[model samples]
Target chain A: MKKILNDPAAVVAQSLLGLAAAHPDLLRVTTDPAVVSRADGPRPGKVAVVSGGGSGHEPLHGGFVGPGMLDAACPGAVFTSPTPDQIQAAVSRVDGGAGVLLLVKNYTGDVLNFETAAELLAADGVDVRTVLIDDDVAVRDSLYTAGRRGVGATVLVEKVVGAAAEAGADLATCERVARAAVAGARSMGIALTAPTVPHVGEPSFTLADDEMEVGIGIHGEPGRRRERLTDADGVVAALLEPVLADLPFAAGDEVLLFTNSMGGTPLLELYLAHGIAEQSLVDKGITVTRRLVGPYVTSLEMQGMSLTLLRLDDELTRLWDAPVRTAALRWGA
Target chain B: MKKILNDPAAVVAQSLLGLAAAHPDLLRVTTDPAVVSRADGPRPGKVAVVSGGGSGHEPLHGGFVGPGMLDAACPGAVFTSPTPDQIQAAVSRVDGGAGVLLLVKNYTGDVLNFETAAELLAADGVDVRTVLIDDDVAVRDSLYTAGRRGVGATVLVEKVVGAAAEAGADLATCERVARAAVAGARSMGIALTAPTVPHVGEPSFTLADDEMEVGIGIHGEPGRRRERLTDADGVVAALLEPVLADLPFAAGDEVLLFTNSMGGTPLLELYLAHGIAEQSLVDKGITVTRRLVGPYVTSLEMQGMSLTLLRLDDELTRLWDAPVRTAALRWGA
Candidate 1:
């Protein structure tokens, strides 16, 4: 696959160096490659939240390491979850006097690694809480496959729950908020093209120019459905309908709508999908109090989009409106 | 080229509808195909800041809209700047009791469109100021060839200067902060593979499996140099040497380093680059005060990376630390 680095093996290391140089105030890297955190460390008494995953998704764990997001993000190789050593180091680095929370996405490697790290840290007497995000609506039931992959809803989980963590909310409250976001959220994606994995140097799945795949995961995994290409409105409806049906959102329910691009779809198209999504929500009598349309949670260079809706309560809405400071999701004056 | 868009022409309109539906509390669609603030109207007597560009770059002008970022963002067609009419409407919608400021990237189209909007707004007795971000060090010619094309540094400008504007800093102060960031910053990028523009339907440029393009732009524009791929440490040096040399950063100079993926790069690689860059900065005696590593600004699905450095002073540091409330950027309690 085409890429910009001198060597694939060195890509992660060089990129981390570049990141540290770029936002020295907000992030710092440990010498052992196990920890990345705000240079200023955690705020006093606030529970430190640490998250990690394989590295293909930018801004997921790293760009999210800041004031209102994860205290530190440990990135592993592309599509490979970080080693237990890395997670344990991150736990040690960000474990302030209050405690530390581990936000692990539902991917098996991520969960297993974080779980192991939690045990090791527990043995070391570090207070830790682990929150597992399993919000992808696409379910894979087979002997060989892990359950449903954590797709685009991970971004919303980070944003809402990250704010709660930053508000001096304890580990329990943050975990509650995160769980609420996970339970209230559902995401469905459709891909028109298969992405080339860098290591493989070829397309993961070949699709005709006119064909599209639905329910894609972050690793270019095959979607749950494949069909002939559809118009923007139809595509948006196909994505949103499944999510709404599964979540069963009620009328007048305030929601946070996130139309996420899977790497390659332009903002114009994402916004177009956003429009259709808005109309769909209005037609369904759902009140969308907030919206985020962009490539927040993405698959690597996949040309597609996902629609994520978080059913909001008064608390979720207020938490969503709270201020945050991170390398990626920052807002509030 | 591999995009999932239905019709390239309808992408913008569709996306605007989605944004309106998604964030009714944050954005409202103007009749003229622009997204305006949902906050009644622009506050009376506040200096309105407006920004925009092509639709491919997400979380830019659109995500940066809130109390601190742009009052409104005028999104154009994918990879194309908005027309004067759209800018005029955006300016009008966001113009409050105070004046308006146009924060523009240094591309020719963007500069021209925003300049025209500024002139038109002035004709209507709206006070307007324009700050052009020309931080990309890739361009060597200042007296010719449009100088430098604005890339990832635009995010920093918007956040820091947006915070100033949100805090009631006058147009002059905001302008000064914006310019300070522009002057103190330098960026350079390299593309591994070019993105497929929606209309083009193919890669903008081609490279051998082993070759790399250095000094590239956010779009698929060719870079100043191309060479055989090297190791990550060497690549980081190649990306940063030019920036440091061009800016003449010396020992003890505190800087902000940004490792920006030109769309398709994995965050794992970005963090690797971050580590290498941090070592380089330390080795060269440069004290980095901040770092941001991710795809903040992107070029469709281009596979590449860019490095940005901002020389920080006390004022810039303070402004950088200021709280901001936008869709993408938020900080403080």
Candidate 2:
């Protein structure tokens, strides 16, 4: 695989070095266990929210580390779950007097590791809570997941729940917001090309020139089906049909529609797809009051896009509109 | 090309429709002349900064339009210059009483078209000025350029110069800052794989599996040379040496270092290279007082990156640190 990297084994550690140097005022990175926490010291009585996962889906958990989003992030090797020790380190670095909340994706490895870390934290007398995000509507189970694998909704949950935590909410309130976000969101993605893990040195999967995979997982896992690639309208219909049907969102529903690039898809194509999705929702009588378009959650340079629909309520809308200043998603102050 | 698009020819218009839908608060997009202008009414006495170019570069001219940046952006078809009529339209929409400053890249078509637009506006008694960016340290002349091709430094110039214009600097003052930025900045890129234009349905250029092109142009034009692929450290060295020598950066100089991905390269790899660039500068006793790292200037889904270093004085530094909010770059504001 032709990639701009050195030894594949050192990708995460070296990348953190770069990230730390690039934004020293915003983040403090520790390499031993790879925890990226806010540069500002921890608060004495504020709920500390932490999240993490594999490495490749960048600007995700790590880039989201700051005051308005994740307090600390434990990034493991690409596509591999962070060890329990790494998660424990993140908790140790960010735990304030109030409590800790772990935003865990639904993948089996992430679930297991985060659970182990939570047990360890509890033994240390830390009040920690867990929220699992399983918003993908593509499948009930997958290669590395026991249920619908978490996808793009992870970004929405992180933003909304993190805002609640930042607003001085208690651990229970943060957990409630995260659970609501997870329950209200659904995602589906199509892959035009697969990603190559640095160590793997080759594409994980292969598709013929004219074929595309529907409902593909972030790690290049097989999706629902394979078919000849079509235009953006067809692709948008394929992804949105399953997502909208699963949510069964009806007329007069106001929602936040997020159109995401898998990795290699350019913004031009992604925006084109988003336009089609917007029109489709309008025709269905659903009002799209909020929209996000770009690559927030992504595979490692995989070419395609994912669509996530979050059924929004007044509270969720307030949380989303609240100011956030993370490296990935930045807005008001 | 395996792009998520419909009717390759409609790519620009359709993408702009999506852009308008996604960011109604920050932008007002008109399709007939294809101008993306600020949603807020133009500041009557502030110098209007307008820029446009080919559309393949995702966020260069359009995504950078917002408060404290470009007043308007005109995007043409992929890899083709926008017509003079489109530029005239953008000028009409954003021109305030303080006059218009047109930022043009150093490509033949861009220079010719922007000059023609300026002439048309001048004929109508609109006080208009032009600043051309030629900061690429690669080749002196290439397929589409008459001088060093404008690349990553265009983003730096736009951010710094746009901020100056927003601070109420007049036409001459804005032009002076833009020229200083163009003179002070230097860039060099390396591409592992070339980008493909939708209409052409083929890669702009080709490379063997084990080779990469150093000093590669943004449009996939031939660079200084083709060599075997190497590690990230080697690639960083290759890029930094030419950029440093071209600008003749000194030991005590303070600068802004921008590490950019040319579309398909993941942030993981881009940050790694950035880390290396940081250390290299530190070793040379140069202080990087400012930093911007991302895919701001891209060439569709090209698998590589570019490095830009802008020599900074107090004025440029302050302008760079000023509050500016755009779809691609937003901070402080």
Candidate 3:
């Protein structure tokens, strides 16, 4: 494993230590629960948004923590879900009395842990709501998930709902916006190589030099099929067609198109893919009203890309355009 | 090689097409010579900052084109310097009546091409001043450089000097700040695996699974030596020692610490490296007043990182803290 880590088991904790040091202006870290929260947070009477998941998919839950995005993030170990206690700590730490909304990816572990935390909090009289993001249109069930695995659209949900929460929306309104984001967004990914969980110290799966996994999961779960590697245009189309079909995203639709690198792919190729997706949408008479292209949602050291299209209404569009001050996604603020 | 590309030769062009599509509000792409310029340009008498170099390093020259950063960028083919004509196009496009300052990386090709463009424009009575950045303290002379190779600190120079220009500083003042940034900064990198040049279809260099190259250069240039892999702290020390020694950075110096990834590494490891670097600087009695930790300057998909330290005085610190809204780097604005 040529990863820049001291001990594989301590990767998450140590990385958070680094994150805390780097963005002190934006974040505060709690080691016991491995929660990262807004440095200036828990404002009285304001709704708070929190999300958590396995590590490796960076800038997802943790890097999104700030005033305009996630108020807190509970990061578990690499490819492993955060415990319920971690989720509870994040909720308690960021709750500002209005209520707290949890954005949970639809993985089994995430749903279970977040649900447990929400129940525990509710028993204690803390108002909490959970929105499950099962936006990945890949496999219906996979190694770690019994339904569509949450992927790229998680970033979109956080951005849009975080905007709503930042605008002083109540807990019910925040949950409503979170559901709107989760419902409107869809994602699909392709993997050229598998990600190596740090402790595992080897690729989750191996592929021939000229092969790829279509409809791959964030954690290297088996995809729709193994296929011969194709050019950029073909790759984009293969992923785009399925995503468009699943959403029945058709002509005259408007979208917030996001072309994201899984991990190892550079912006040169990611943007190349983004351009092809744009052209494909243009040819279909779909208008790309907003754009996001980068390695925002990633699988650690995995070489691939995921395309996400969020059918935006006036509200989601306005929220997305709202100023955000996160470590990863920032604009308009 | 597994890469997300259509044609190796078309990667730069297609990526820019995607870039233009993704950031229409921020940029305007010109294909003839391949330059990315700010969509809102030629602000009457604002001194424009222009930088260019080989491609492959995303978010360096091209991604930095916008308000409060480079006014325009000229990108060449992968790891190859921009041609004189490309540089000329960038100069003519972004130059306002005030003047144009060229930030050239200290590579033979970059220096030659940018100098040619500056001289051609200078003869035509368009004011121009060129600042050469040679901040990499890895090796005196390497594969692509005669003096010190320009590495991670290119981002710092563009940022500080770009801020100076954005504030309407004269061309001379902007050039002075650029020079000051270059003089204060130093960088060193290590590569565990070589990056694959898309056209080459092979690793730039091969390494055994457990071995790593110390003091490696961007573009896969061989470094000081090859040795067994070490932990993150060890890896960081290997880089920080030389960077400190080269500058003879003192105990009381306040600096901006930049821990940059070489593309393939994820944020988990990169931030871990940043934390180690921060501790190392603290141990040396150095105060890190500002920090930039991410894969801002990259070499395609190389699995390694570089550490850069820019000793900041009051002016440089203020300039560094100024707003920048490029595709990659943005804050305060």
Candidate 4:
């Protein structure tokens, strides 16, 4: 695998070290269980928010840690789940008098581990709650997930709920807002090429030159089906139709449209996809109130894109627009 | 060939349209001559800074057009320079009567077209000056360039010089500061896979699975040489050694370290590269006072990374930290 890594076994640890060195003003890395926390975390009487998953989808959980977003993020090795010990350490590091909330994606391993960590933290006298995100419409069942896989909406959930926490919401209030955000979001993805895990040193799947995987999972799992490659508009339509239908957004409804690259896709193409998506939504009488287009949540060097639609209320819009300073996503800070 | 484009011939125009739609709060796109200018432009008595080149480098010229950065950017077709009419139109739109400054990368097409536009603007009673950036250490000369090709350092020059202009520097002072920044910066890159231009329908070049091109140019041009692929640390050393030796950075020198992906590489890998780069610099006794890491400047979806070091003085450091707001780069705002 033509990747920029020292050793296959050390990719996750080395990358975390590099992240800490690069963003000294924003993040601090702890060695023992490997958690990245805000440089000045543990704000007294403020609800702390933490989330994490596999390491390859960067700027997701780790890059989201800051004053206004995540209090801490515990990253696992590439395409792997973080251990319960690591999650507990992150919770302990950022717990304030208010409490701590866990944003867990719907992967089976992630759900189990975060739940175990919550139990451990509760035993240690720290109040904790969990909100699960299962927004992906790609697969109802997969090797790694149960009902549905969480995908792009994890970023949105973190941003909105994190802002609510920063606004001095109580633990119960934070959990309610997190669940609301999760319920309002849906995502679907397509892949033109498969990404290679470092240790495997080969692509997870193979496709013909003119074939593509529609509704693919983040970890390169089988999607809805394979199809002949199409142009930008066609591919965008296939992805957006399902997401829009799943959310069942109606006329006069407003949304926050996010077109995300699954890594390896250039910004130029992402913008093109965004344009098509906006037009498609308008045709269905949906008004796009806010737009974010880039590689915010990505698979490792996977040349594809995902479309996310978050049915927005006034509160969610305001929370999203709130000041946030992070390594990847930043605005109004 | 495998890109998300509607029509090969209309990629640039369509992408520009999408950009204008996505960022109406920050930018406005002018048709007929095709220039992206600040939503509120021609700030009276302030020197207007402008830059542009090929369109494949997203967020370089177009995304950089906002407060404390380029006043306007004129994009050409993919890997092609904008015509003199387009440049003249952009200068006319943002020329506030103080003067206009052009930041041209040292490609023959860009230099020639920008020079022509300068003469046209001077004839129209608008003072215009040009600062050419040639910091790439890859080639002494090439088919499209007389000197070294301008690579990642163009972003640094635009940022520093744009800040200088915003701080009320006159045209001459802005020009001088830009030249100084360009002189202090040096960059080198390596490519594992080549990016295909939309119209070309094939990669600009090809590389075997076990081979990599070192010191490669942004447009898939030949670099110093090709060799067997190595680990991330070894590749980082190969890139950093030449850049450090070329600049001959001193023991007590303080510099800004920038690790940029050539579009396709993921943030995980870029950070991994950044970690090794920082260590290598420290080993040579150079102090990294600041860091900017991302795919700010890119070559479509080329799979590689480039390292840029800008020797920093107190003034440059302060300017680098100045408040700037753009789609791609933002800090202290």
Q: Candidate 2, overall lDDT? A: 0.92
lDDT of 1 by residue, A159-247 (tens): 77778877888888888888888889888888876666566668778888778887777777777778888888778878888888887
lDDT of 4 at A80: 91
Q: Regarding DockQ, does 1 or 4 come out ahead?
A: 4
A102-181: candidate 4 lDDT, tens digit per residue: 99999999999999999999998989999999999988989999988999999999999889998899999889989989
TM-score of every prediction relative to native: 0.84, 0.99, 0.99, 0.99
RMSD of candidates 1 onward, in order: 4.1, 0.8, 0.9, 1.1
Question: What value of lDDT does candidate 1 attain over all alpha carbons?
Answer: 0.76
Q: Give the range where candidate 2 chain B is weakest over 10 consecutive residues by summed lDDT.
A: B324-333
Q: Candidates 1 and 4: which is better by lDDT? A: 4
i-RMS for every candidate: 3.4, 0.8, 0.9, 1.1
Q: In candidate 4, which residue pairs clash?
A: none
Docking level for model 4: medium
Q: What is the CA-based DockQ of model 2?
A: 0.85
lDDT score, residue B114, model 4? Answer: 98
Q: For residues B61-164, write the lDDT of model 1, one tens digit per residue.
A: 68677766678888887778888889988888878757777888888888888888788888889888898888778775432228788887898888788778
Off by over 4 Å in 4: none
Clashes of each: 64, 0, 0, 0
- After TM-score superposition, what is the CA distance of residue A311 in candidate 1 from its true location, in Å? 2.8
